[model samples]
Structure formats: C-alpha cells, structure tokens
Target: MSAAGSSTESARRVAVITGASSGIGAAAAYALAQAGWDVVLGARRLERLQEVAEATGGRAIALDVTDQASVDNFASQIERADLLVNNAGGAKGLERFLDTDMEHWEWMYNTNVLGTVRMTKALLPKLRASGDGLIINIGSKAGLDPYENGSGYNAAKFGLKALTRVLRIEEIADGHPVRVTEIDPGRVATDFSLVRFDGDQKRADAVYADKLNLSAADIAEAIRWVASLPPHMNIDTMNIMPRDQA
Candidate 1:
C-alpha cells in the first residue's frame, strides 16, 4: 500500500475487484493497476490475492461474496471506491437440470448472482460517493444463450443479467450518476471449466481444445475500456466472443 497522503495514491482512482485471486478478476487487477487505478483485490484465496496485489501494486483483502460478513468486512477496508468489478463468480456443474445436484445450483447462484448482490450493495455507498461511480458485472455467454447441460450456470448468469438491468433502471430512476455495465464473454480459457468439472483436467481441457478462445486479459481489457470512459458514456452491455466461437 502507498503511504498516506501520497500524491500518487491520492490522485489515482480506486477500483475493487472481486474474485481477484484468479482468472478474469486477477487480470482486471493488473490491467486497472497499470492504467493508474489503485486496485483492491478480493477473494477467498489469500495467497493468490496477495501475489496479485503485490504484482499490481494494489491491496489484497480477503472477500467471500457468498458471506455477508466477509463482504461487509471487505467493504469496510475500502474508504474510497470509484469502481467495483463484481467478478467473483463461476459455474459448478454440467448435469442437466433434472439430474443436476441441488448443491451445484445453490453454489452457482450464491456465488454468481447473490454474491454480486452482496458486493454491489456493500460498495454502492462509496461508489455513489465517487460522484461518478461505475459497476462492471462480469457475465458469461451462457447468460446470453443457454446450452445443453448448463442449467445451473445458465440460470445464475441469466439472473445476473436481470439484476444488472434492474439496478441500471433503479439508478436511472433515482437519478444517480452511477454507471452500470455488464460484459459477457464467450470461450475464455481459464480455470472456469476445471472448476465446473470438479477439477477434471481432461474434461476441462477439452472445452477449448482445437478451438479459438479468449484470454482473461482480453476480457479485462474490455473492462478497462468501459471504466476509462467519460462519466456520461455508458456501455450498457457488451458481448465479446472469440472469432471462432460461433
């Protein structure tokens, strides 16, 4: 962390990134830090978050979006937040809806939908305090178009889509300056598949095998661009896919 009253730290904006321990969240931290934003990284994994924070010159705070207390504690550490990247979300299983374990559904919804809610609500005050706050909710292509055996993840992302839209409407209704954007990407190569398959490396590896896929950095760049835009500009929603994803 930079010394208090340091001009460099004071001049730069602060961005809080959830799920910053890995994948898109970690990538976003580096990208934002590089672009002169003081990033606050949050995740359940302390070691990974710490490493990312050190690498990006940011701060690491243990945050579990699924836990309200953790979210509150995480928010308490952030005195100022110009941007909140709700990136701490993922899929859990590939079984069809009927055959899928309920536990899979619960975890997916909790992490992807409710988790975003917890963080957004916790950080909204500061984001509003920024005078030109921005919230970027990381979404998935599954949210846009569901696929076979993706019932749980699809449901979570779709719910996230609705949540993002409603929040945008509410803020607009209240006439707040907060900006909301949802970026949905397709075929990003990350640990996402591995986690979804319960660490089955072969199954996870096959998802992107012999196919074009986006990197975590690619989605992170989109987030950076959206955040860097003028306050009056709103991306609304953006869907980025690999050239060959279709």
Candidate 2:
C-alpha cells in the first residue's frame, strides 16, 4: 500500500474506515483511496471487505465492532493512522420504548457507543503520533431530533455526539494534534433502514419511497472534503441532509 499520507508528501496520511462492507462507509473508503490516502477497510464480512480493498488497492481486516477482541485485533494490525472514521454503527430495533426488547437496546449501545469508544481508544496513540489526525464519527439527525419509536437508535447516536464533542475539547487541552468531527446525516438511501428493520426489505423501501434522499456518495464526498483540508484546519462537525428532507 502507498505510504500513509503520501498524497501530501509533507506528511503521509492513512485512513481507517470501519463498517466498510457497503453503503456510506464503502463510498468513503473509495473516496479516500482516490485522494491518495492509503486506506484500511474494516468490517465483519470478509468477502465484501475484500472487494472494497481490492477496488481501492487498500487493506481489509475483519472487524466486529461489538466484540472487544475483534476491535483490538483490527487496531493492532494498523501501523499508522491519520484518520479514523468510526462508521460502524446503526439502529437495531425501532419499536416504541415500552415495546422495545432489551436485546435491541443492548445491541445499539454496544455497537454505537461502545464500539466507537473501543476503536478510538485503540487508535488514539497512532492518531496523536500522526500530528494532524482526524476522527470522524458517523451519526444520524435523529440523534439531534428524535422520531417516534426511535429511542434506542436516538440514544446511541446522541451519546456518540456527546462523546465526539468531549473528545474534541480534551484532545485540544492535552495539546494533541487530533481533531474530532461528528457528521449527522438525515434520510440517506442505504441499507441502513433494511438493517434497522431486520432485513424487512419492503418496510425499508417505504422509508424513502416518495422522498428525495442523500446517497452514500454524497456523504463520502463531504467526508473527503473535511479530511483533505490543511493540517492546521479542522471542519469540527457537520450535518447534511437532502434539501427535501426537512
């Protein structure tokens, strides 16, 4: 693989993207690769991960966000990282609070909150060492404005936003070169709803049946813009949605 940050030469930048099997994460991986950053793709599916890695000429590692061992192993395999895209989170069950199962809530908490934390902790040192590191946490607009029957998903994303903010301040205080950004997207047309609905394709289709929506490429472009900025500048946070979404 190209040396980390070779695109800039002054500093080699390497990006690690999680949940890169498909959708936004996969698009982001391609965008970074196109921009000349060596990329590392992480996800649970080896076959899909291999596809992305081969396409981008990057590396792929099997990663299960909710499992500590898997997360650790993924981190250990990385040599240097300039960007960590914590994009491996999603909503599990969309039932009302009273009807929500504990398993669903647990899944959300583990994957969204704990998973981000696990990946951040494992890669922080490399980020700090890079001298101009960035962390982009993928979140949802629902995290800011809740929707009915979205308690579990909302809670996890809300926590993710909070975590990103806190890390931003703490890293600056510690004189670290790391920056944290949280991207909250609204109604993206991806497999997100399908996964949320537990493989119910028809229900998933209904989410954006009559509405304009952002594509995974849209978010990936935004991410690339933020990462390509000068080392001294950071985008901090952004919220993107289709014009018709609101």
Candidate 3:
C-alpha cells in the first residue's frame, strides 16, 4: 500500500477498551472493530488481549488500571482515541456489610472506581483532540439498588455513577465536545459470578441456569448504537436488564 493510503487508514477514529481480555470489554472491541474503528485493547492479560486483537484487526496493550505506571504506559500506546470504554471492573465478593472481607471491598473500589478515574485521565487528552470524544462506563444494577450481600460491589458502582455524572457535567460546563455515558446492566451472565466466588464454576452457572440473562453481545450492541449516534447527541445513562430481571 502507498504511504498516503497507510496514513489515511491510520487516521481513522480510534477506540480504546479496558479489560478487553474477555466478556463485555472483549465484545465491545469486536463490535467497534467490525464497524471500522481502530480498536486498541488494554488488559493485564497479554495473551488474551492479543487473541482479541487478532480476531478484530486491532492492537493490544498491557494495562493495569490500579497501577499508575502501567496505565501511563498503556496510554502511550494509543495516539488518538475518540472512544474510550472503561469496562475493566468486577465484583470481588458478595458479602453483607458486617460479613464482608475488607480486602474484597478494596479490590472492587480500586478496579471499578479508581480504575475508571485513571483510564479517563490518561485518555482525556487524546479524546479531546479527536474533536468528538465519547466515554462509556459500564456500571451495574447494584449502583441503583442496594441488596443483601451487595454492599461492596454496590459502593463501587455507585461511585462510578458519580464519576460518570460529574465528568459529563464538567465537560459540558467547560464547553468540550466529549460525551460521557454510563451503561448499567443487570444480571448479564458472564464470569462475573465465578470471579466473585473465586473461580467456582458451579456458583457461576447457577446464577444463570434458569434466568433469561443478557449476553455480552447484548451490551456490546447497546454500546455500538450509542457510539454510532451523531456527536451532538449524547446518551447519559442506559439501564439494561432482562425482562425477567425486571
């Protein structure tokens, strides 16, 4: 290919996804890549990231949101990101406030709240330079409703909601073209339960056995639709759940 052709192709809109090793983040990477965006995936798992990148014709970067150096290095790998999906988060343990392991709460907070903050800060500049930037933060139903044994996870997601809101408000007030969206999904069957239960497959399977749960693809489609909208239109928050969940 000619140098000009290569440059033109490289100039396409870039989309950076955190936690792109699996589940919702991976799904988003594939969806955006198929739609012609230059997808750059970030995750701690290099092999998994490479696999996703290969499948989607994207690039992979090693990222650990809880660590500043890792995040800075990851940010350096992406030049112009018009879309940033902060999906690198998970529930640690389903425990009531009193019964909770404090360490679990820390993990949840660091991954969900702090992680989003770190990634957003690192990518904000590139996003702003794009002339039209968008951030999609994946939240949860727990953010809206506190339930038994959901204190830690709920707290983290609630914090994310606040971050999403404040960021949108600040950007709008500052007269920036960056759009922020928070997608709160309920009961999507993923490895969420397994991780929450510390790699217990049975526990994970039971969570979705009889329920009509949303797939990673379902969430990915919503993300794709939101990203496809004109720059002037912004979807603030979308609460998605299975009919049964409602």
Judged by lDDT, which candidate is best?
1
Cα lDDT tens digits, model 2, 4-118, are 3454565557899999999999999999989888889999988999999999988999999999999899999998999999999888877999998899989998999999999
Better structure of 2 and 3 per lDDT? 3
- What does the lDDT come to for candidate 1? 0.92
Error of 2 at 173 (Å): 1.0
lDDT of each: 0.92, 0.90, 0.90
What's each prediction's TM-score?
0.96, 0.96, 0.96
Error of 2 at 150 (Å): 0.4
Clashing pairs in 1: none
lDDT per residue for candidate 1 within 1-246, as digits (tens), equals: 221112464567889999999999999999988787899999999999999999999999998999999999999988999899999998887897789899999999999999999999999989898888999999989999989999899999999999999999999999898999999999999999999889999999999999988999999999988988888888999999999876
Which stretches in model 2 have alpha-carbon errors above 4 Å?
Answer: 1-5, 8-11
Candidate 3 local lDDT, 115-213, one digit each (tens): 999999999988898888999999999999988989999999999999999999999999999999999999898888998999999888998998899
Please give the distance, in angstroms, between residue 242's alpha carbon in candidate 3 and its true position after superposition.
Answer: 0.7
